[model samples]
Target: MTETMDRNFIWDFIEDDLANNPGMKVHTRFPPEPNGYLHIGHCKALCVDFGTARKFGGVCNLRMDDTNPAKEDTEYVDAIMEDIHWLGFNWDDRFFYGSDYFEKDYELAVGLIKKGLAYVCELSAEQFRDPQYCGDLTHPAVSPWRDRPIAESLDLFERMKNGEFPEGKYTLRAKIDLASGNFCMRDPVIYRIKYVEHHRQGTKWCIFPMYDFAHPIQDALENITHSLCSLEYEIHRPLYNWVRDNVDLPGNPVGFPRQIEFARLNITYTVLSKRFLRGLVEGGVVDGWDDPRMPTLCGLRRRGYTASSILDFIGRTGVAKSDSLVDIRQLEACLRDELNATAPRRIAVQKPIKVIVDNYPADKTEYFEVSNNPQDSEAGTRKVAFTRELWIDEDDFAEVPPPKFFRMKPEGEVRLMGAYIVKCNEVIKNTDGSVKEIHCTADLETGNGMPADGRKIKGTIHWLSAAHCEDVTLHLYNNLTTLENPSAKPDDKDYTDFINPESKIVVEHAKVEPPLKDAKVGEQFQFVRTGYFCKDTKYPNTFNRIVTLKDSFK
Candidate 1:
């Protein structure tokens, strides 16, 4: 972590904590439950957790909160680690797992039971949440087993852990103030029984501690100085504090892990909930978890979003206490800003229109020197082949030109980007009245310099030599959800109703400059006048558009 003057409220609080406490270390942890692939929302938390720690020269642990075996898997665990690393954060030697401390957490549960601070309850899932019994924790609504004998409660807890009792038969709840306004403090369940196999722990323990109970203990055991989480857990702060105060932490430090909540990332046009995204995958609405249309970190990467761009987006979004929806354009703008300076330039014709130069020798092919990236001088230049036969964008040519149309038209002159000026002389039509070919004559002296007459050409269009171009596929992406707030629909309306039918458009026979034939997967380039694109990792000869050349959001 590099020391810097830039500070957010989180860092300000940490600075005060460090100033007050002499010789204490600044430490934070990114504890993500390995239940599903990480989404864009997690990226914000990741940056804050790791970025803060990095700024202050503190250690950040990457802990897996895999307390619930029912939904967790090693696959998600692997994906979570990959996503974190992909975002340019490393956990180093501080990687830990919540399930790894099951024995210690079990001991703490026993300590709570012996102290009469926790007990085994028999309330079913529904009955426990019944407003008649637990109305916001504002009044005393005791469970039937609240006053059970310590010995009996402990016995039941042991039996529950020993697999003698099936799941839901018994649960350990904290014996806190039942009249507290905060429901989280109202004797929250600390542990529950589950007979499922754990991803890491295997069948070692059938009884697992609940998230609220396990998270703090795991933090304390690992000496985590701060626990960063989203705003939804703000109310649970009281409970988090209660666990740290009640349990005899391993380190017994003068101070314990402090919990801070920040607004989670929300973007327009799509839902970020794991369940909704999983539904999209399962319902065949999306290709898979890594579908370019999805907001998963892996999906964004596959769609050509660089880690720096994502980090910049997070930085621009800033850390806020209040929740808000960020316009997706901000993210796209960050990506464009990054790619504009980094991606090399290339020429790709999405809709190929054949052009034949009558004055140029058909058998002669010449090369024109073109800069690979005008923004980057060190990127140098490459030679693009020019010949009598060329391919340009269909939209760039119109037989009956529209008003002010500067591209190729009957008898209209335009400059071939980095090549000679050409004048369209004839337009060949097919039986369907669509253009079949355009015959043009190029001024031999106009190339690599001004024309002899110093004529100004308003239109300069990219082109690829017909004999030297490579056939490629272009994938143009649009918003995945038609509705701006797809997840906010009425309960009766399905989220799938907002799925954008034209989200993914494929151009199968696009033509690109010959140099693109060697483009490796993940290599990015700006398709001059089209968009920024990356060679597809999943599909051969395909380039996924990162963003259009200009901002549409404005």
Candidate 2:
């Protein structure tokens, strides 16, 4: 069942499914709980559901499993929709919510009670807390109230629905098995008494169905053929099918949705769980959910990631059953590959140092013709302002550079990106002993973007006019968690405790070209030698680093 997927294997599976029932319609669904923003892992399942359906000429549904009321929110639903659209998926009008079947679900629960197949149990939270509550392979402990009369059960269930019972007083349990080999088959709770108001359903349902019991029925109700999911739901498939078989569904008996499990996406040095991600945000380890340093979809967007690149990445990951961790570099490689062809290039400086063109006239300012994006011939060219005093990265020049250093050093000549070839004459020192400025002489005749004719320079450094520079905020992002694998850690030390506080560092003094002053919030731009950065939604004045220029940090 877990063999490697090849072209032959894929065709074989499709042929088998087609041969099994020639007329059966193929339908798939991407069901997500609206608790938090979707991560990169969710993208894997998304591609499988929608991609598979489209390939097979079937329909795919975008369903929200809004079962738990406490963590779910309208904001999450909106975010999820936005992400799906950003990923280029159109559900048309097939968007469905689990809470939409409230009335029908209640009738089904009542039907089970009437058949004596389900009983309302009065087990307290303390009972389940014990390790021995779920008995071993040979023995299974029966709840004392398991044999309560159906009349009393129905009466108590009605009272439970009437709001007479407290939150945990009564729960509807399926009488599937008390001594079955499967632990989940041991009379699992079908419905729990939750008194909280749902985000979508409001206070209409106090007795809500458990996810394990409701998911399969809901899938069947919507005529979902393939319930695509992560590997984690592998064990829950049996329980998923059992609920559909026992309960009477709407219309035909075509509600037996086949559960298909694929490998969950795992990225190196990235913590993908919502709870751990929430901890990093709530604990102030990172800025917020959309912080470019974080791995949430919002964060990735804020970090200047393109939706097409993400889709391309998921496609490259392929469909497989083996669980494995993806190197973060591979993800970045996809990003760089896409951005290199799409994003226009611009020169910006981070730690600007003043370079005085002593030879050039002090008042003169001009624009140097530069390639907008070298990779894109259609991108054409743009103009950059070159002034008497220009700003260059502090690291570009070394007062006492190494013997073979090719950049700006004393008596060394380097092209000023779009401007002139300049030679450092003198280094000015500040009161604090830091290099305040470097005086240089630019050959006005050779100040063109590239070297004149066959003339050459050892290196070309990027620079912006100091007199025309605009202050831009910069956010340098790092991994959210310090631990490589937080999920594999011991239970004692909270994973949140290991969160790196320095995940995101804000740079308020970074300088940029005047052309970028109008860059809107969440916009992306290539920072020349720096990296791809997006306009921070939280701080519209700044840009956040998504990934470096290269995919590999090494």
- Predictions in order: lDDT: 0.88, 0.80
Candidate 1: give the clashing pairs: 1-54
lDDT of 2 by residue, 337-357 (tens): 877887878777888889999
In candidate 2, clashing pairs total: 0
Model 1 stretches astray by more than 4 angstroms: 1-6, 136-139, 552-554
Worst 10 residues of 2 by lDDT: 1-10
For all predicted structures, in order, the TM-scores are: 0.95, 0.92
Clashes of each: 1, 0
Alpha carbon lDDT at 368, candidate 2: 80
